[model samples]
Target: MTEIRLITFDLDNTLWDVGEVLHHAEQQMRQWLDANVPEYTRTLDRDALTKIRTAVVTERPQLGHNVSALRQEVLFRGIVSCGYPATEARRYARSAFATFFQARQEVVFFEHALEALGELAASYQLGALTNGNADIQRVGLDRFFSFAFSSADVAASKPAPDIFHAALNHAGVAPQQCIHVGDNLIDDVHGAGSVGMHTIWVKLSDQPNTIGHTQPSEVVEDLAELPGAVSRIHTA
Candidate 1:
């Protein structure tokens, strides 16, 4: 077996429960908007904002990869529609997005997440490959992750080959010398596998592997099992 030199991780659900973090962040952002730009809060509801997001992505498909831009554009449009001038709308949108982004970084890791990363980082170079807008620096994950890439970095999200290829290039490793660990079957398993890298599926639940055509080299339900799984793959 080729020696595994790099291990790329998905940040969102793999490291922490993103749904709760996002919900809390949204509330914090909404509170900021209400205090600063009451008009936006009064005018746009969740459904309305969702429709604007859909339109924004529809007109500019490239924004799909850069979620930060997509969200800021939505805020700008919503603020403008609420009768704010373009200049004020842009300023408010940026401020609101910053507030949301800061709040978004407040993540609670899964049990043993830090410990597992520490163990893995001792022997292998650790990288992060995420489609979401979570900043590793803001989240204080920079100590564990030597390099990080997001969808925005390569203008392509997972299930696409660009981000994985970027990691390979950055690490200077062949596909067989890398392993990608992520929670999603399609985005993590299929995506890395498509690029000829080994994969470990972080199955947080009992959901059956519905993607029958693709299989991960290892499946682990908890981060505690991560180092062992990687060791097994490395030896095999």
Candidate 2:
């Protein structure tokens, strides 16, 4: 068995509960809409905004461009379609959506998240690979990771091997020497495994049980369990 010298983490649901944070963001966006775009209050509800955003993103997959930029575009479209003046729509959209994006930065890390990161960082070269705009530097997790790569920066999202390969290259390690941990089954586990990197599925309650679905090197319920899992591979 190969010793694991590098441990890469997925940002959103791995280190923190992304669903909770996104719920808060959605709440904030709805409040902003209600306060600013009062005319379409009944029509442009939270569910409506979410549906429209999903459709727009699906239709314009190429515009997986920038999460923030895409988010802004979606909010602007929502507001304009609600009958707001174009100038007012742009203004409120920028102000309201910027607040929502900034709120994502306030996402709370799981208990022991930093401790687990620090522990892992001590022995192995640590890096991060995320699909979203999780600015590790801005989030103050930069110290824990030697290198951080995002789909936004790589121009390729997860389930694509390029993003994973980019992280491996950044860490100066081979695929076999590193392990990727993420919450998503397809993007984090299957994708990394496809590229010859060991993978750990960070199981979350919201996600269905993927135990028999895809083979990861391991499955951990929380980030705190990661260090031991990685150590076992190194020792074996």
Clashes of each: 0, 0
Q: Which candidate achieves the best TM-score against the true structure?
A: 1
Candidate 1 wrongly placed segments (more than 4 Å): none
Write candidate 1's Cα lDDT for 1-236 as tens digits. 66999999999999999999999999999999999999888888889999999999999999999999999999999999998899999999999999999999999999999999999999999999999999999998999999999999899999899999999999999999999999999999999999999999998867776766679999998899999999999999
lDDT of 2 by residue, 102-156 (tens): 7777779987789889998898888888888767887899898878887778777
C-alpha RMSD values across all candidates: 1.0, 2.6
Q: Which residue pairs show backbone clashes in model 1?
A: none
Cα-based TM-score, every candidate: 0.98, 0.86
Candidate 1 minimal-lDDT segment of 10 residues: 205-214
Given candidate 1, what's the lDDT at residue 67? 91
Cα-based lDDT at residue 96, candidate 1: 98
